[model samples]
Target: MRMIFIGPPGSGKGTQAQLLSQRLGLLHFATGDILRDAVAKDTPEGQRAKPFMTGGQLVPDIIVNDIVNARLRSKNRPVKFIMDGYPRTLAQANSFDAVLKEQGLDLDAVVFLNVGDEEIVRRNGARWTCINPECKATYNTLTRPPLTPGRCDLCQHLLYQREDDDPATIRRRLQYFHEQAAGILDHYARQGRLIEVPGRGDIEAIYASIVKALGK
Candidate 1:
């Protein structure tokens, strides 16, 4: 199935998207990962994106759209895809739909992983990531811990708290999330293709519900 997964940061949508893609043989499309890769590679587009990204500003729509369009055209793209962390605005949704139309593909479902803002803040605040530029494995202070505290098991890199994981940033993120995404969710709902799924349970339980939702 061609799908989109929408949820606040730390709502476990990435894990869900990854698992769902594997389970259904869909390509996984993650905008954050793509943007990071582009910036690291310093491609012409990435050069254009770097200043804005490092400044903690949104990359312009044209740059993001171009990167996404390029990735979608890669050979071996799955007939189906599970998209996450993208189309965060109605404008983006329109831009994305137009691109897909040109490619002759249509989205099948938009999954809304509904988790409370309080839970979202808690989840993110508790998260840690490896600081080594070469390794960035993530862990949650409560849910998952490395064998050694504050260290990456694979690379022995020190784990660091992200600046963006602080309460202030989390609050800012939530405000933007509701402001930009609520209407897009409503738009999808109006089309009879939106599925609201609770995201506050065990992974398997959540995946099971997703399967039932998709009826596959």
Candidate 2:
């Protein structure tokens, strides 16, 4: 039941992936989490990724590809996984297929969470995050504000709006996502494996649609 989850930021696809993974007993491979773990572990690849990360620059595809491939080939890898926040570009998607091929694995589905740009911007504008490095809890200004404004409810750490969550940056990111997503979507669509799910309204409702789409 290998699957890839694709969506713009604030689409709630990550939450859906977690739910689906738990229900199906599939490994949840979130690329950001994996990369952050590697960095925290200070592995060789992590050391290489640190400079780019500290500078707020995107890690090169080669490094990301290597990390993903290593994880997929690890003995601890589950027979099935739901990949999130990966294959951001057409090149990465193509390289990913090669990695799976080498491992005798194939993707069963590519789930695209479809959220409109306006909604994405609106949702992101309400986003906030913990400023403390040790406590990175996220909150939304509109939907899920912390008990105290600008404070993490759990750790009492100061909370802030991520620069990327600004309306301008959100628009920029959405544009980039759509541009890259087209080719990636076409790649899976041609394979008859792409599943588009409406990503609006209630979270459970969105997830229900995903389950139906996957016929699971």
Candidate 3:
């Protein structure tokens, strides 16, 4: 299934995307990860995206849409894929639809991970990630912890808090999510293609909710 995930920054959209892609055999396409990798590599797209990211604004739709099209056009790429953290605007949604139309494909549905701001704040503010490239273990200060504080149990690598995961940054991201996602969500809803999954409780429970909501 060609699916899209719509959620706030801290709503576990990435986590759920990774999991659901594994479970459903779909390619997991995360725009943030892709852009970050490009930035880490100092690619052309990253150079263009860096300033916008530093300002916490969405990167220009033209650049992002080009990257999305490039990935979708790759040979032997997965026929079905799940999108995470793209199409933040109605204009981007229209652009995405146009590209898919050219390719004779379309999104099956958009899954909105519906979680409250309080939970989003709590979950994101406490998150940390392993800085080591070889072992990117993720943990949270409150909910999930490593065997030792600030350390990854797998490779004993240091776990560092992402600046974006800080309380203030998370709040700003949440606000941006709501403002930018409103029109996109409503657009899909009006087309009878929006499926909401309550994003609370354990991973398995949330996974179950997503599965049921997707009717799979």
lDDT of 2 by residue, 1-216 (tens): 999999987788889999999999888988888888899999888888888888989888888898898887889866699989888888889889998999899789999999999999888888899998988999998889899998999999998878988889889988988998899999999999999998978978898899999998
Relative to the true structure, candidate 2 reaches a TM of 0.82
List residue ranges in candidate 3 displaced over 4 A: 36-57, 125-166
- Report lDDT per candidate: 0.85, 0.89, 0.85
Taking all chains together, each candidate's TM-score versus the true structure is: 0.77, 0.82, 0.75
Looking at candidate 2, the ten consecutive residues that score lowest on lDDT are: 70-79
Order candidates by TM-score, high to low: 2, 1, 3
* Tens digit per residue, CA lDDT, model 1, 167-202: 678989888889988889988898788999988789
Clashes of 1: 0
Residue 172 of model 1: what lDDT?
A: 91
Clashing pairs in 3: none
Task: Give the per-residue Cα lDDT of candidate 3 at 27.
Answer: 88
Look at candidate 1 and tell me the lDDT of residue 144: 94
Task: Count backbone overlaps in model 3.
Answer: 0
Selected candidate, larger lDDT, 1 vs 2 = 2
Task: Give the per-residue lDDT digits (tens) of candidate 3, residues 26-50.
Answer: 9888888887787788778778888
